[model samples]
Target: MDEPARRGRLPLPHRGIAFGGDYNPEQWPRETWAQDARLMREAGVDLVAVNVFGWAEIERSPGVYSFEELDSVMDLLHEHGIAVNLGTGTSTPPPWLTTAHPEVLPVTREGETVSPGGRQAWCPSSPVVREHALRLVRATAERYGDHPALALWHVSNELGCHNALCYCDESASAFRRWLERRYGTADALNAAWGTSFWSQRYGSFDEVLPPRLTASAENPTQLLDFRRFSSDELLEWYRAEAQVLRASTTTPVTTNFMVTAHIDTQDYWSWAPDMDVVANDHYLDHRLDDPWAELAFAADATRGLAGGAPWMLMEASHGAVNWQPRNLAKAPGELERMVLTHVARGADAVCFFQWRASRAGAERFHSALLPHAGTDSEQWRATLRLGALLDALDEVVGTRPTSDVAVVFDWQAWWAVDAGGHPTQDVRYLDEVHAMHAALRRAGVGVDVVSPDTDLSGYRLVVVPTLYLVSDEAARSVERFVVGGGHLLVTYFSGIVDENDHVRLGGYPGAFREVLGARSDEFFPLDDGESVALDDGGVGRVWTERLEPRGATVRARFTDGPVAGGAAVTRHEHGRGAAWYVATRLGTGGRDALVTDVLEGAGVRPVLPGAGGDVDVVRRDGDAGSYLFVVNHGDDAFVARAPGVDLVTGRRADAHEVPAGGVAVVREQPTGRRRPSEEAPA
Candidate 1:
C-alpha cells in the first residue's frame, strides 16, 4: 500500500465511492440550490465540489471579501448531507483586480498582453498575482477550516491549463532566477544550453530570457529548459497556496492535473508529489476513432501516476465536452462504461466537470450531470443509474490492482523525442506509446503506462516505446529491472538523447545500447505509404534503422529497404532476463505477433484468454478479495469465463454472460484457495 493508503483514505466524510462533481450554485438562483441538493441525494451523490471559479463573487475589491452567497450554498449542501471539495477559487482573478493591475496578466511569446475575458490569464510568476491568489486561498481556508461540509481543499483548479508558458517580463525574471539556481553560473548555463553555437553564449543570468520569437527557430536546449522552468514556476504557485491551506486546516489539498500527452507544458510527474490526493481531469478525444481505448489507456496511466494507489477522477464529461472540435454526445451506455473503466483501473472517486449545466458562459454548452434539458433528460437518468451502480460497488474502495506488463511513458522522453530537428516530423511519441498499450488491451492483457522512473519490481514485462530521453538514472534502473529477471522490449528512436536534449555520443540507442545488444548507424525514415519487408514475412514502415547486432540473436532483418538485410529486431540475454530491440515501426500484425511471442516467453497470460474481440478484462486485489472487471466494447456478446460472484447482480454464476456494450464485475476467491488451472484463465 502507498503512504496515503496506509495512513488513511481521502475524499472524507463518506466511505465507498465518491459520486459528485463541480457544483456552481453561483450560476443558479437561490431557490435552485435546494432543488440541486435534493436531486443530488436522489442520484446517490455524497460529494460536491464547490467554489471553483468564484473569485469574482467572493471578493469584490482589494481585501474586501463577501462569503454570504457561498455560505448559503455550503449550508444547503450540508443540510442535504453532501460533502464539499472546497476550491480556493484562484483559477481566475476578478475583473476589478485585472483592471487595477494589468501587470498581473500574462504576456505571450509575441509580447501581447493577455486580456481578462478568459480564465487563468494571470501570470504565475508575477508577485502581484501570487499575492492576490494566496490572499484568496487564505481567506477560503479560514472560512471553511472547520466547516461541517468541507471534505477536501481543492487548490487552484488546473494550475497550468492556460498560462503555462508566459513570456512576460515577470516570467522572464523568474526564469532567469530559476536558471541561475539550476546552473549556478552563466558559464555552466552556456555549456548546458550549448550556447557556443550561433554566438548565443550568455555572460550573465539576466541575459537569458524565456524562449521567444527569434530570427529563426529557438535553441532546442534553451526551449527545453524554459519549459522546465515555467512548469516549476507554476508548481511553486501551487505549493504556496497549498502551504497556506495546510496551515489553516487539516483538509487534504489537491489540484486537478491534466493527465494527457497533448498538454506537455506542466510535467505532472514532478508535480504529483505535492498533491495529497492525485486528482486528474480527463476528456475523451472526440477526434479519435476509438475513444474508449484512449480512456482506458489514460485511466491506467493515471493509476500508475498515483503509484498504483486509488486516485480521483476529478473531472470527466457526462456526455459531450464543449472544447472538442466535433463534440458528440455519448452513445447509449458509454457514460457508464467510461466511469466503470476508471473504477476498474484504480479510481476510488468519480466526478465530472460540473453538476448543473451553465445557462450563459463560455462553457454553457458543456454537458453536465443535470443538463439544460432538465432532470427528465437521459443525461440525468444516466447519472442516477451510475450513482446507484457505485453504491453497490463499495467494496472496491482502497483496492490496488497489479499489472504484469508495463509500457514506459516518460515526460522527459515525450518532451525531448518530439523536440524540433528530429529525423522525421512524423515522430509522434503518443502514437508509439498507444500502439503498445492498445495491443495489450486488445489481447486482454492488463497494462500499466508508467514513468521511466517508476519501480519495475511488480511488473514482469516492461516495454519502452520510443523513449528518446534516457537519463543515466533511468537507463540504469531499466538495466537493473531486466537483470533482476524482468522482460523488456525497447523500440526505435529510444535512448538517443540525454536529459539536456543532447545526443549521447558513440552510437544510437545511447545508454541502452549495451543492454539492447544492438547499435544503429543511421535512420531510414520511409516516405508516405512506403514500407520495408521483414525476414519474418512482416512489413515495417514509418521508420527503419541500420542495425548491427552485438552479442545478440537477430530476430528479424529488413529485406527491401535502404538498410536491406540489416537487423530489424534483436533479442539478447542479459543476466537472468532478456532484452528485445525493435529497430523499426512494425505493422499491426507484426506488432501483435511480436507482443504475443514476448508474453509467451515471459510466462505472462492475459486476464481473459481467448475472450477476444474488444472484451477488456482487468483484476484488482483488495481486503474484500480479488475483483475481475470484464467489459465488452464490441457489438457482439461475450461470455466471461472467470469464476466468481457477479457483484453487479449480486449472484453467483458458473460463468458471467454479458451482452454487447455490457459490463461484469466478478468477486473471485482468494489467491491461495484458487486452483492452479483457474489462475487468470489461459
Candidate 2:
C-alpha cells in the first residue's frame, strides 16, 4: 500500500476493479477511434492502455518526435471518461533507429545479434539502447505529465523476450561492470559462477565470457549464472524506466511478467520488489483446472509480494488466444467467475491483450472485447457481466486481506529444478507446485504465496514444494520458524541440490533428508502413465525415490508394490516442531489428501468444512479482519457449501448452490481483538 500510494493510488484503487483492455488507435484509422470508444462504453470498459508499442509512430525519425497522434488519443479517452495507462513505447525499437544503430539489437543464445522487428530485441546492457529507450519514456511523461486521464505508466510491453543478451563487446564489458557491482572482484565472480571447474579462470575482468552460445553452458554454474545475469538484465531495464517515470510523473509503474513462464526466464521474487505492483500476462494453457490453480497461486504470489497488496492482471483473454493449439471459449459463467475469483484473491484490475480483435497478424484471431467485426458478442457480454459485478462490489479492488498463511513458493528452487538435469524430464514443477497450492486453497486455507527469502515468523504453517536448492541461510530461516514452534512441510526433491544444481553429495534428498526424517538412496522417474504404489501415502508417477531414515518418523510407505517397504512420506521432529515430507508426485486426489492431513494436524483449516473438491476456499481470518474467497474449478456445475453471507448482497452463499465456475466473496466480522500490528507497527 505504501508503494502503491507512493506511485499515486491504492493498489487497485479503492473505487473498484479497472475494466479495460489494451487499446491501440495507432493500428487503425482515426475514424475508428469513435466507434471503438462507443463500443467500449457499451461493453462497460472504463480503462484503456495505449502507446504500448507505438515506437515507430512516436518517433518517425532520429531526434524527431511525433506524439501528436498519441496526444489526441489520450485526450479523446479522457473525454470519454476512461482512465489511461500510457506505455513508454520502448518494447520495440523503431525501424529507423534499429537500421542506424545496429548495436542496439540483442544477441541471441546462439550468438546471433538480431536485426529488430521483434519486441524486447534491444540489448539491455547496451548504453545506446538505454539512452534511446529512456529518452522516449521521459518524452512521453514530460508531454503527458499533468493529464488527468493518465493513471498508470506501463513501462514496456513484456520485459520477457527470447534469449539472454549482450554477447557483443559492449555487453561483455557491461557484464563485467555488473559483476563488479554484485561481487567485488574476479575471485568472487569465479566462486559465484564456479569458474574453476572448467579451468575457465579469468586473469582480468576483460577475459570473462557472456552467458551465450560462445561461452558454451557445459558447466551448470555457467548456465545458472546466465540465468541470474539475464534476470538482472531485465531488472536493469525495469529499474531504468521506473526511475525516470517516477521522476516527474507519480503514476504507478508496472511491467508484465508471464506467470509460470519458461521462456522469458525471470525470477519474480527478485524483480517484484522494484514494482509498485506486480503485473503479469497470465494466459492459461488450454487445460482449465491447471489454469485455475495457476491463476490462484500467481495472483496470491503477486499480492503477497509486498505485504499482500493487490496486483494487476495486465493481460487476459476476452475469449481465447490464437497461440494455444486448442483455444477454447470461456464457458457460461466462467469468465465472470474467473474475474471475481482474482478479486477474491487480491486483484486490483484485469486487462485483456487487445481492446478490439485484429483483422490481421499472429494475434488477429486472438481474443478481444470487440470481435473481428465489433459488436456485443458473447465475450462482450461476459466482459460486461464482470464490470457489472465490480460495480456491485463498489471498489473492493484495492482492499488488502490482513489475515493470511504463508506458503513458500521458491522460484529459485523452481528455476534450479528446471535447469538441473533431473533423472527424468517428465517431472512437472509447475503441475506439482500448483497441485499442493490448490490443495491448501481447497481446504479453505488463506494462502500467502511467498519465497524462502520472505519473513516466515508470521505464519503458523509454512509449506515448501520440491525445494531442490536450500541455501544455508534459507535453511536456517526455516529452522528458526520450526524452533519458534511453527509447523513445516517439505516435499520430495525438497533438499537434494545446492545453488550450482549439484546434489548435496550425500544420499538422495540430501540436506532436507534429516529435516524430513528420511534419506533416499535411489530415485525413480516413471513414464507419465506409470505409477508406483504408496502404502498410506498413495501411488504416484513422474518421479519417486527410496529413502533411508536418520531421525524422524516414517509417515507413509509404499504398499503392495516393488518398493513396498520404501518410504513415501515422512515426519521429523526438529527444534520443538514437526516437518512433513511428501516424497512422490500424487494425482490431484492423493496430493489433496496428504496436504489436508497436514493442515488438519496443524488445526489451521480452510474456512469451508468437509470434503470440498475442485473448489478452492481460502479464508483470511485475523484480528485485523477476515475475508473468505471461494473459487470453483471443476468443469461440471459445482456448488460451494461455504458458510458465510455474501458481503456484496448479504445473501447466504448456502441459500443457493453457486453455479459451476462460480465464486462467492464473504467478508467475515472480526472478533473483539486487535492484530499484533495494531498493538505494534511493523
Candidate 3:
C-alpha cells in the first residue's frame, strides 16, 4: 500500500465508480460556470479535475497568487454536489517565470531550448522550476486543503508528458549527482557503463554527461542510464510536490500516468508506489495494427501497477483527439464499449481529457464530453449514457479483476532492447508484448502485465516477450517461478542482456539458457516482408535464430531459411513445470496455437471458454457479487451463458445478449453454472 492509503486517505473516500473529466472553468466565462455545473448534474458527473494547466492563471507574477475564480469554481462544484480532483496548476510555468529564469527551460538533445508556448517546458531537474512549482503546490494546497469539494490532490497534469528528457547544464549536473548516489564511486560507474569501450572512460562523476547528440550510436549503457536518470528526475519532482500537498491536507495525492502505447519515458512501475491511487491516461493510437488489443494490454498493465486494486481512468477521449496523424472520431457505441472495457478491467473511475471542448488551443479539435456541438451532439448523448451506465454498475466500485496469466513488462528492458545497436530494428518491445497479449486475448484468457520483479507464485502461466535487459535478481525470480511449478513461455530476443546493458557472454539468451534447456549461437534477421516456413506449417517472420536444444524437445523446426532444420520452437520439462521457447516471431495463428497449448497444460481457462475472439469477458468480484462484463467488439451480437441481472438493461436472464460494439454488465447469481459460449442470433 502507498503512504496515503496506509494513512487511510483512500482516493474517492465516499464515491462509487466516480464519473467525470477535466473541467477547466478558467477557460470559460464566469456565467458559463453555473451552466456547466447544471449540465454536470444532468450528466451524472460527481467528480471533476480542475486547473490542470492553470499555473499561469493562478500565479500571474512571482508569488502573486489569485484564487478568486478558482474559489468560485470549487464552491460551485461543491454546491452542485460534485467533488474536485484539484490540480496544483504547476503543469506549465508562467511566461514571466520562463522569461525571468530562462535557465529553467528544457534543452533538447540537439541543444535547442524548448520554448514556453507549450506545456511542461521547464526542466525537471532545474532548481528554479522545482522551487516555483512547489511554491504553487503549497499555495494551492493551503487554500483548498479543507475545501469540501477537494477529494484528491492531482500533483501535475502528466508528469513527463513533454519534458521527460532535458540535456541542459543543470540536468547534466543533476545527473552526476544522481549517478554518485547510484554507483557510489566513479570506478563503479565506469565498470557499469562499460566506459572503457572506445576510450570513453570517465575519471569522475563530474565528467559524465547526459547522452547528447553523437555522430554514431551512443554507448548503449550510457543511453540506458540517461533514460533512467531522466525518469527519476521527473519522479523526484513529483515527490517534491506531493510532499508539499501531504503536509497541507489529508487528501490523497496522485498524478495521471501516461500508460498508453506511445509514451514510454517514465518507468511507471517505479512511480506506482509513490501514488496514493494509480491513475492512467490512455489514448488509443489508431496507427497501431491492433489498437483495441493495445488498449486491453495497457489497462491490464495499469491494473498491475495498482497492485490489483481498482484504479482510475484519468484521461480518455470521448470521440476524437487532436493529436495523431489523421485523427478519427469514434464510431457509434465505441465510447461506451471502450469505457466499459476499462471499468471491467478494474478502473473505478472513467474520465475524459476535458469536460468541454477547447475552442482555441493546441488541442482545439480534441474530443470532449461536451463538444462544440453541445448537448444535442452524439458525443454528449454518449457521454450521458455512459455516465448512467456507470451509475447503475456502482456495485463494482472496489472490486478487482482476476487473471491467471501474467506477462512480464519492464521499462528498462523497453529502453535497452529498442536502443541502437540491436540486430533487427523490427523486434520492438511492445510489438512482442502486444502480440503475446493479443494472442492470449484471442484465446479468451485474462492477462496481468507485471514488472520483471513482480511475484509470480500466484500465476499459472507467465509470458516473457523480448525482455532484452534484466537484473540477476529478477531473472532468478523467474527461474524460481518455473522450477517451482509455473508454466513460462519466452519469445525471441529475450534474456539477452544484464541490468548494465552488457551481454551475458556465454550464449544468446544467457540469463535463461539453462532453465530453457536451449542454446542459441547466432541470429538470422530476415529482410523486409520476409517469412520462413516452420515444420508444423506455421510461418515465422522478422526474426529467426540458430538453436540447439540440449534437454528440451523440439516442438517445431525451421524447414527453410538460413537456419534450416533448427528448432523453431522448443519445450522443456524443468522440475515441476514446463518451459516453452520460441526462437522466431511466429504469426498470429502459430502464436495463438502455442498459447492455447500452454494454457491447456497449465489448466488455465478463460473467463468464458468458448466465447468468440471478438467478445471480451471479464469478471469483477465485490460485496455486491460477481459482475460479469461482456463486451462484443464485432459486427454480430454474442450471447454469454451466465445467469445474472443485467445492470445496463435491468433484466435477469440465463444468457445475456451483448450487442455488436456494445457492452453488458451482469451481476451474477450464486446458483447458476456458466457454460461459456458465443451463440449467434437465429
Clash counts for the predictions, in order: 0, 10, 0
* Model 2 residue 233 distance off true place after TM-score fit, in angstroms: 1.3
Rank ordering of all candidates by TM-score, starting from the highest: 3, 1, 2
Q: Write the per-residue lDDT of candidate 2 for residues 1-682, one digit (tens) a residue.
A: 2554633324432266777889988878999998887777776677888999888898888767898988888888877788887898888888787788887787765777787655667777778878888998888889998788888888887775563445776777777776778778888777766677768877767776666664344666666666677788878888999898889877778888776534437877788778877777776666555676677777777676655765777888867788777898777767766676666766667788889888866688898877765454666666666667666664354456543357777666766677645777776566667777787777666678888877788766788887777786777788788777667887777777677666677787776655666777788667667888876646776777767767878877777444668777778888877788877787777887877777656556455554256766655443345566666666655455555566545686444355566766665544543332233322
Residue 429 lDDT (model 1): 87
Candidate 1 per-residue lDDT, tens place, 1-682, comes to: 1365423455467889899999998888888988898999999998888999999999988899999999998988999999999999999999998999999899998889989898998998989988888998898889989999998988888888889999989888999999989999999998888899899999999888888877797899988888888889988998999899889787788889888756878887888878788889998887876677788888998887777777899999999999888899998878877888899999989999889999999999999999999988888889888998899888888776777899998766777767678898787888888888887788777888888888887777899999998789989999998898888999999999888888899898888998988888888899888899999988998999888889779999999988999999899999888999998888888998998888877768877667644888888876667888888888988888777788888878768887889888888866553321235334
- Candidate 3 at 232: error in angstroms? 0.6
* Structure candidate 3, residue pairs in collision: none
How well does candidate 1 match the true structure in TM-score terms? Answer: 0.97
Residue 383 lDDT in model 3?
82
Off by over 4 Å in 3: 1-10, 671-682
Q: Rate the local accuracy (lDDT) of all candidates.
A: 0.86, 0.72, 0.88
lDDT leader: 3
Error of 1 at 122 (Å): 1.0
lDDT of 3: 0.88
- In model 2, state the lDDT of residue 539: 70
Please list the Cα RMSD from the true structure of every candidate, rounded to 1 decimal place.
2.1, 3.7, 3.1
